[model samples]
Target: MHDPIFSKSFTRTQRHRFGAIFLCFIIALAISKPPLHLLSPIGDAVKTQLSINNVGNMLLVDDGGRANIKPIADVNPAEYLQLPSDDAQNKRTSTTISAYSDNGIKMEKKHAIICKNSNYCKIEGDVRIDAKSSTILVATSFANMTKSWCVIEPYPRRGTSRVKKWRVATLEKNDISLPICTQHHTHPSLLFSMGGFTGNYFHDFADILFPLHLTSSQIQKKVQFLATDYKQWWINKFDKILNKLTKHNILDIDRETSQVHCYNELQIGLKFHKELLTLNSSPSMHTFKVLLREAYSLKRERVIRDINVPMPRLMIIDRKRTRVLTNEHQVLRIARKLGFEVVEGVATDLSRFAEAVNSCDVLVGVHGAGLTNMVFLPDNAVVIQVIPFGGVDGFARLDFGNPAKGMNLRYLEYKIRENESSLSRKYSRDHPILRKPELYRNWDQVWSIYLNQQNVSVDLRRFKGILVEALTLLYYK
Candidate 1:
């Protein structure tokens, strides 16, 4: 015998009770920091939020400069984040640091670093940060012809709650420190450094999706893009904002410094060389950069210090845990026969994906968030993406704004058997694969069981069109 008002009244009362408890819990947390010794992944999220806030303050305020507000975003934009086999928290790694290259510190595939403490480190070094947990990050340097990285560790650590001063000095005339990298350097030209002066502070600001400022000229040269209506909304938003900031002075892309694929905190458009600031392990962003730098036959290459130890090839990277596509192996086999290098790797992280793509001439994948790795590829690299009849077409059209310059789009239609009536009308249908469904209804629909029972063959004609399209683009130079 529940009264209408009484039943709802109980619900309301319980809600209020929980709210009070939650409010009190927040107050308790506000009063004191949690015991960090009880470190767990659950605390990782909280620590990250605080870190983002800390980085944001470093960029916006007159704290006159700090670590180029590391761009650890609020969201993990990875397309696939496979859960661990067990529910237990992973504790194998001690820390996560940003690693950069200088004279004394050396890189091996982006992570698994080696450092030699010497006075020579002053000429070409980067910054190191204590990002909570016993972890230290070795991030890349944000400066001219220099690279940096940060390492994260939880063992045999240095630094305390009050001070994080370590082996490197970030603010001396000898070594270009992280904070000084930002404050001291304002004229980042295409020749001296890379980004921060490439695009308009307003329009180019909108192109990159993060809050970074860029000047006009760099936007014109480094920002290689073909415009479309979809980009119009972003362009409009920036134009309005610029009108206010300029007082009609910084009129358009003509005046503002441009944004490029470089890493900066106040203005995060994109960064191709962020490894110089991030601490990644071998087979990582740092590794790729180290190899590319060596390709130029720099002093780092002539004197093969550490990374030259036969790092993993692109194909083995395909089998790494990051790649978890359903038909990955199958597609690789087919692509190999079709005269394409079949690398089976995933661009799970955006920055890492950018690094991976820079190493390849062609990128192919099923049309999914996983394939946005297109953003990472070199200009004019061909992308052949499979479009499942159910979902892919609409998304591919939007992902590529211009069919001419940045991306070469190719679509492969998925195979789907039509309605049962079409098969029934086939004259003398000897093929068991397409046998009349009415008579075949006796078979269990379980796919694996029936496949073992019946020999099947389908026409390969349709796939040839896609292969030809891919080869044509490959030879395009």
Candidate 2:
């Protein structure tokens, strides 16, 4: 017979000890009201997003986001939908049309065409579709939002078709919507964007006479170029760049709108060196010196003006959706405003992003991966973030986690509305079409808040105070 007293005795003592420690911990936690919320689960999620690494068996998909198991139940092999091979429609089902040289050794052109969708008509990619598809590998299908208009990016080279034979696909956009395509025969046709001038802009040469139609081999060549010339920086940043490029290619890419914003070989290499020099020389960097300022009172403020576009003392913008400003353009505006020479940071690869950010006293941009550069910023840097007007992300992480050991982190956010959170949350509640809970929205915003949200408030005055302190410390570094 087991002694109940023994089991109860240890259990009781363990509970009592744990309870006592818990009380003390709670008391200490209350006293601190910690800025980082080290113990809060929300904080943990934040930390997870910002700094946690995925280990073995932990998969990352959707651009460094956590891996997930598909929720749909196992399919009955016999019942699975299958495309017919012998049927006329199925035989003509090749969505892609390829024009090759007589020798068949060369591809003259490969076009993906789409004649119609719900109420829209447009070319999706190099391939065209005459049928309706809810989601597509590339957004070549005509999709209607509140109204009908073609949306394109990276490169824009499509004009709405004048033909009245088709119309834009009806898209029901609202909360709980995962924008999809529909078909309509009567209405204004949306001539959506085209695709594949070059597979991806990263290094494609559609502009050249013998435009280097690209392949994995071509991208590899560019990667090699980066490694060879920018050897020092490239070695350290290759993994980051490779991961970013591959994932970008797989997801979040609308073959219709995706292109390399900049792919010139010369331009790519120069981007890194220019920023490295700038960051090392920037007065904004004095991480080592700023630490000592607390012991003695030192205040530094200098009049600044944007060299190109005048950026307010505090400017918040977004980057994920599209990067409209060039490095030099952006740096010139903000740095000049602060009385520094206009700065330009180039991106031959990923690390250049870090070098560029470290050159500034303050950095501002959207809730996109580029801002992840903040992780590499010199300690004592100030960051201003802008949430997308209608975008959300769950796994998106930024580098502004608890001020790196000796760093002081500050955040300023501006938005189209009062709602503040990661873009994932914004869309989760209102995707235009197929939105669901687990995958509907990244749900990341549930953890993130805008600077003005009741839960988190960051004002300009406080921001400037950090700048002032940062500037004061630069003299020592």
Candidate 3:
């Protein structure tokens, strides 16, 4: 029954069948989008071809507005990879396809949700706000089996410790259960929470305002806001800045509990970079400073670029709570003696305080939230942050020092002696709380003992030198 010629014939026929199947598979991969490379041997070739077609010759403009037509080689293919969609037959795709300009340059494609698993999601598409349930519903055809819903904190910081208290769910659009939109708008809406250390001025900027600026500015400030964890006072406080940001109203979503608000597009959370410290990238710090000045109607751009300008104005932030400058009057006296026009920053009302801070040439404060007003200071101004005794130089630097440098302001840190700290009254010289604060178990001890209970009676003679340094920097410039 085993004939050699017949056996050879069967083997050839089987080989032909396998070859046809493999060709069909390759052809299918060539037609399909996304993961096509994963299935094909010529993946790299396909990706390179796509890149050449999409991003090779792009016109890029530098800061001086010089447009250079350059071909960017070694571009990452992943960013240019076609976004996947579940419904291939649907005419209106879930995610907006990337459009090219008239010159064939690729534009930023609109996305439904760019998610990093269940933990963090940045949604920007046909988003609906169901205020009653505190749920954000996005209409997308890409809802998949893995995750159909996401829970987000809506704040910039997504760390578990920062966001554990607040939770908002982003759901896939469902027609049957979802409420009909009472209010519909064309502009993209920005959804965020005013929770988690909002009252503190430092957090007010770092956590909320700066991040909001980055997000809104990216879209050219053409957005509406839907705010949860509503605080009217907070709104009133920054009304100028908020009003400048959007032409539309900022709706308190929590207050609008019975209604569903919808937008043509929505960015469900604020964008932040580098721990919300520096505006290292485009929409730079200069842009933000311009926005601030325009918002507050501030005139000053710098601390008098001419060296002939006399007696640069100084602002001493007088803290009423913890970390009070016990010898602030003495400090003021010395500042006046140094040919400075001293004004006290009590910070009773922020909008007014912002104006005053802008008018000044130098800001002096104990290491606290009041120093956050340095954002309002003009360029080439100086900031003197008197660090309280407890070896919190790193914390002080992170919170204010680094940020000040990024804002184009001169910075000086005056580390107080143990005798200058109010802690000396409570703890002995040899006590671990004073001698070795590193031994403290956790943040609780760091906060309750060092940040909360501490006050600085800064040595007048030592502090004067720092203030003099600030004066010299401002006056000479």
- Candidate 3, backbone clash total: 0
Worst 10 residues of 3 by lDDT: 37-46
TM-scores, all candidates, are 0.28, 0.26, 0.71
lDDT of 2: 0.27
Candidate 2 positional error at 229, Å: 29
lDDT of each: 0.28, 0.27, 0.60
Q: Of the pair 1 and 3, which is ahead by TM-score?
A: 3
lDDT computed for candidate 3: 0.60
* TM-score of candidate 3 relative to the true fold: 0.71
Report the lDDT tens digits of candidate 3 across residue range 110-219.
33444321222456666677766777766543232112343555765433232322232333355456567888887777777776445445566776788788778866
Q: Give the C-alpha miss distance for residue 158 in model 2, angstroms.
A: 42
Q: Candidate order by TM-score, highest to lowest?
A: 3, 1, 2
Give lDDT tens digits, candidate 1, residues 1-477: 223543344444343344334433432332233222211110111112233234222211011122121111221211212212111111221122222233223234222222211100111223222212212223432222122222211111111121121232122224533222222222221110112111111112212321111221223223222111122323343343333222222212111223211111111012211101112232232333333333332222111113333221122123211112334555555556765555546433323444555555555543223343443444445555443221123323433322213223233333323221123233345655345333332212211112112211222354446555655554533
Where does candidate 1 stray beyond 4 Å? 1-325, 347-355, 401-404, 407-461
